[model samples]
Target: MVSTQLDAHEGSGQNSESEKPTHVETEHAAVTYQEKNAFQAHADESGEGQNTKMTKRRFMALVSQAFLWTGSQIPVYLFGGVPPYIYADIGGHDRWTWFVLANLLSLAAVCPFVGSLSDMFGRRYVALSGASFIVLGMIVCSTAHTMNVFIGGMVLAGVGAGINELTALAATSEMAPTAQRGKYVSILIFTIVPFCPSVLWAQLIAAHSTWRYIGLFCALWAFVGLVLTALFYFPPPRVNSEGLTRGEILKRIDFVGGFLSISGMILFMAGLQWGGYMYSWKSAHVLVPLILGAALVVLFVIWEGFFAPYPMFPRRINQAPRILTLTLIITFISGANFFSILMFWPTQAFNVYGHDPVQVGIRGIPVGFSIMAGACIVLWLLSVFRGANRSLMVISSILMTAGCGAMSVARPDNMSTLWGILVLAGLGIGGIVVPASIITTIICPDDLIATIAALTLSIRVIGGSIGYTIYYNVLVAKFTSAAIHYIGGAMVKYGNITSTEVIGEVIGLTSISLLDEIAEVPGIAGNEALYKIVIQAGQIAYAEAYKWVYYVSIAFGAVSVLASLFLGDIASYITFPKYQHDSQEFERWRGVRMSCEHSLAEIITENN
Candidate 1:
């Protein structure tokens, strides 16, 4: 029955009798042309076949796919703009930090595995499962009353989100024509532009109601995506696989290697988070985890290289050309700088200017819009120049360094200046991230594009986790010192308080509303003069601390600039023909030669 249906569809007659081919020879020639074109599109361009026209069905499918990717991204943006009052509702001083850490860690850990799962099962099934997990995670987060429970829910949601993100990206790439992959990806990412206003919406909801409702909104978004996928998105059939039983395929998974990689990263990142905040840097709690985690990561690489029958890392492809590997490192620095700004810029506004959640969200608009503008700049650069990527990256790094340098001098009185500075930072981040992705796809083997994509996502998330941890610690340490020097005894002379310990307690429990609480102190209450003095002192201290973060951001940006110098000539990836089969074969042969030489050297030494 299936065979007959296939034959009927292939031989279906045209509406116009004159245009229809009556001869069997003509019909065979027509089918062959179509078949060859389809093969070239998928097999040559990393499975991103080109779509020349936008039919109604194709357009609907693109919208559905874009929504899924957008839904995955919304949670990160929401958390980045979360207000100070919302932290109190969650009942912890550092719960926001933990929440961010948990989310990034889960994303890093789950991304590589999700890519493999989709290939083994099917894209649609994997994506549906991800959405279901997100639904469950939202329910947990909405009902949670404790910080620990909330973080647990966020971790669960991160896993689902990671799966959906990669799946949606892969689907979008495959759905569009090869020439239009960038367009599809940009559309998917830009879906967030319309919803950037949701930051303000979340703030309003938090002010009038509770933060739990924000989680509910995200749950509903994921649910809608789930429905769309089930109805319209069908997974394409795989072209290559050897005959094997289901159990055999399951047994081939590199479970041990995957666990080692994920666990090592989680441990290392947790140590970075704990140091200088929860424990001293030299304490057993901090040192032991960091050391053990490093060891485990080394073991993971050793295992993947020698023991694992099916390794997680793409050893051969990673070494050829070396651009993919180099870009991953550059991406880590870029990711770090991007997240550090997004997470901390709002805190600076609220702490220094006494801005509320709504005000903070409004100030953040420039940064969000700047990111979209940066992506557009790349598109324009590609059209005008032959090998424009090197110049684009260098330009992005300069903007980032200049922007961060400018931010160090920002004062509450000169808050207007921040609008322009944020634009530069956003432009730098967006510019680097998008081009890195496109370059990776162009240089990578068609069969390994999904794996490489997952790897890049992991690198970025892990880098973000590291960046947040470092910047948060720097901010805390700097703030503590500055507050002690400027506000401790200085305030005691002016205020009713005899003890400086009272001021210490306030600084210890850091928040945007720190100064507002100083007025409520038992000894300092009802003295407007003393309250004003303390508030001024606090402002000066926060501004100094923020300067330290800006300085570090500038340093990271400089390093990214140095990395860009090494990324010579990507003109071939841009202008050359897709699927240079001879080039790929030569790379594989070179790898084989190198491996044999090393083995032969070892055998010769043993005999001697």
Candidate 2:
């Protein structure tokens, strides 16, 4: 049934006698023709054709890929929690945001190209290259003496992360049956369970030892994954590149589209990251790149839709347009929500709830555990309730919305309430990415899986970039205003500090980095009572500012919930054997394994 639907779509333009096809359809049909011929040619050349079967070698490869994914994620989760220590050591307090931006910008910008290259080349070499970058970046970062050097290292690491993330996901999905894609992907996620406390690890290492060791730790682990990948992962050559010469393959790449997409994403995200934080929203620094980048993005889409011979986002996947589009939307919103928590939860813990680094790290564990649990639950549920994609997404989104919305009431005094809300939100985060990737790979053609998967990952990062910008601006603006009001009022009323200039100077020191300096502000010096009042007021102001950020997040969560509602049913697509030959081969492998187990049981019975 799945094959028939695909065949019908593929043949629509050629067989339709009643009406002429539109230009878009006609172009897609031509591309489809070339893809089919290339696949056939590759199959012919490979000769020893059997469906995708799980051998010991292949199983080991999957395990290696999972480790690579975990290694890549370590740096990402690690960096968010230790920026304070990094900045203190490197002296880039004012430019600290660049630490994250550098990694994210490079990751988002390079993802699509990585996908295209993986498809043009093969997964093994491309993935190995990515692992190499991670090692090199980690070395640079661990030894960095300046902020510029550290940021550069982050850029290299981001590029490596993009490649490893996309390739691992695509490679894993392609290896599994469609019916079990969710299960296999979930298993891959399970590898990260032990490492989910990476933020805690960062805190502990930074507190007890040098923070630079965190980079060394990640570098060492990534090196292990790199060596494993080189030894184990050997995917079949891509269908598109099987018959092409090096020059021909290079020429086939859409350089124009790649340039437009990469440049546009970098410029657009740079503008968003810089606005209101580094410069005013209306300033040319923000507006010029934002507008120009948006225009280029639009142009890139237009070029992909109409002009590019080999587009990064191939038109063939449009057969399931509604499902594809909605999944991307949910993935985007989920990313935004996830990053908001990952980036800010530690801040909230340290500022409002926890007293020390260890307490803050302990507080963060529940959310990480919940996220992994949520993902594992959804993946298992997907297997049991086949084609429950829409239902699962809806539930996940609602959970996220409820948790994020309720978090607005969190206060410095209510530690228990905060933990519960964090768990709720974390579960929602886990349910999104794996399921979305499964649905997307299910709908897309086998050859284009990497391309579509890369797009989803890229969109998620882009969403994070946008979400971070909005939340950052909101939090900073609200915190600054509330701090002036609360702290200044306390200084004047309780401390009896009347001079506006003196109050202003003291209030300015109420920032996260400068909070300790408040007592050193001449008039406040040696006055322990005034210091306590000022600190109390600042905490109250922080609580109030954070509430707005959570409230704003509720809207994004709600958007995801609404989007999930429109996803088309994918029950038949996943359950029905799409690749007949592969299904037959898998069944044979299952029988052999069962027979081997039975024979072993009989031998044990005879011995008894």
Candidate 3:
């Protein structure tokens, strides 16, 4: 039945006299074209057949893909604005809860399927659809007056972001010049390096007008991109004539893979997102979902390998792709430290540097600037080296280790002397992201490029989920231990634990209508002299938390170093690079020469 159906659809037949043939060929000419595609996968085992040439229009499509990739972060971070001003109708914590929920939800659910679908459909359709969803999501956020509506908005926004990634990095692998894929992917994402999601951007915008406009603004920007897809399209096409069909596309879509992968990721992310804020790390609410999520992910891998014909992470095409392997390990560690430092460092600023939340955000501008600078410097270095993928990775790991170690030295009472140290950490973090992306796009096969990109991203999200979870657990344990030790240190220095002056100075209780529980202790005189004991206690508590965060980052970098060492040699994995038969023979000969050299070297050395 399948063969008949395929044969019936085969050939360029305008065999019927009634129908007019528009092209230079018969009506069924397209049908023959489809047959070539349908069996193309089976015919070419070495992946060397002449497929199709890339054109200017496809390059434009690739460019559009990059835009979609970087734009994913906009909606994720834009929520930082609207939630602070959330009316009581939506709980003050409602915005944060929704923001975290939306991000985490996509990691597990929409993101997985979007990636699989991108593999099945083309990058353009999935990406544009995601953009449309993002636009509507933003509009919903703009007008959200109720909790249900707000939640609904977040889901839409997240779905768009999920699909956004499919186009960006994945499409880059497909559309970029064979030799230039790594450079372009890395350079393109660098556009967003300077655009950090500090609460300041949102706060500044909200000062003059309502915060809801932030959502409206994002929606408008996405709408513009949606329009630009047509204008930027070049005349010549870049479609590869690989074996892609509607049924094959549908089968590989892997609804089951999507469901399991996304659900597990979402549940795990939830465990981390709310771990410290809402419940203890060990609480059933946190641990159970994380456990279940892990198990589900295990099942997903099993299903992908043993059952799904066209797996999401097809082992055949990957065969230990270098960039992806390193990306998984490095991104895991980076993902953990990325937000943990930003979220916790403000406490150090408040207690150690004696700054309020506003001042804390203000003082961290150097970190943000350093982040942008680090990205540029890393790009320049990588560009200079000509495929120094492994070397760049080592430099990134070293910087991460150094930065995390320096941040561990931070004190709540005195950060003035070592502000530069904090900026160093930011530089390390920024350095990691772009290089990892460069590797991911270059080392993957053309047919499975999107799938690999999606999988790499999914793993990063998974690492992020687990990273936060582990950080929370460490934070609670260390905070407890440090609190006890800090109390002893304080009592030894001061004569009492909870003296009136100490408590009063330490807890700068706020009654502001907008931010009721904001703790903003001012001046060295008041907090230093009277609240010394209370301030000291908070310092001890925070140091403990920061200590584990530091150790975790160090461990992450250390393990990543080992992973980096094993990355094998970097090579451009262009699928059908100017697919000449002679070129194919040359590649085969090159492989044979490499194998013969290794075998001779082993024999010569052993005989000696």
Best candidate (score: TM-score):
1
At residue 91, give the lDDT of candidate 3. 49
Candidate 3 lDDT score relative to the true structure: 0.53
- Give the lDDT of residue 338 in candidate 2: 78
Please provide, for model 3 over 40-157, each residue's C-alpha lDDT reduced to its tens digit, 9 standing for 90 to 100: 2212212234343455655566556555655566665545433445543254442244454556366435544553354345445666787788889888878877766877887887
Off by over 4 Å in 2: 1-66, 119-122, 169-187, 230-240, 498-509, 517-519, 575-608
TM-score, predicted candidate 3 vs. hidden true structure: 0.67
Q: Candidate 2, residues 111-204: lDDT per residue as tens digits? A: 7676446545666788888888988999999999888899899889988987777666656655554334445655775677776676688889
Order of candidate numbers by TM-score, starting with the best: 1, 2, 3
- For model 1, residues 174-253, the per-residue Cα lDDT tens digits are 56554454565556666777765555666667667888887898889888988888887764542213433345546666
Which candidate number would show the highest lDDT if scored against the true structure?
2
- Which parts of model 1 have CA positions greater than 4 angstroms off? 1-60, 177-182, 236-240, 243-245, 319-322, 509-516, 573-608
TM-score of each: 0.83, 0.81, 0.67
* Cα shift from native, residue 531, model 2 (Å): 3.2
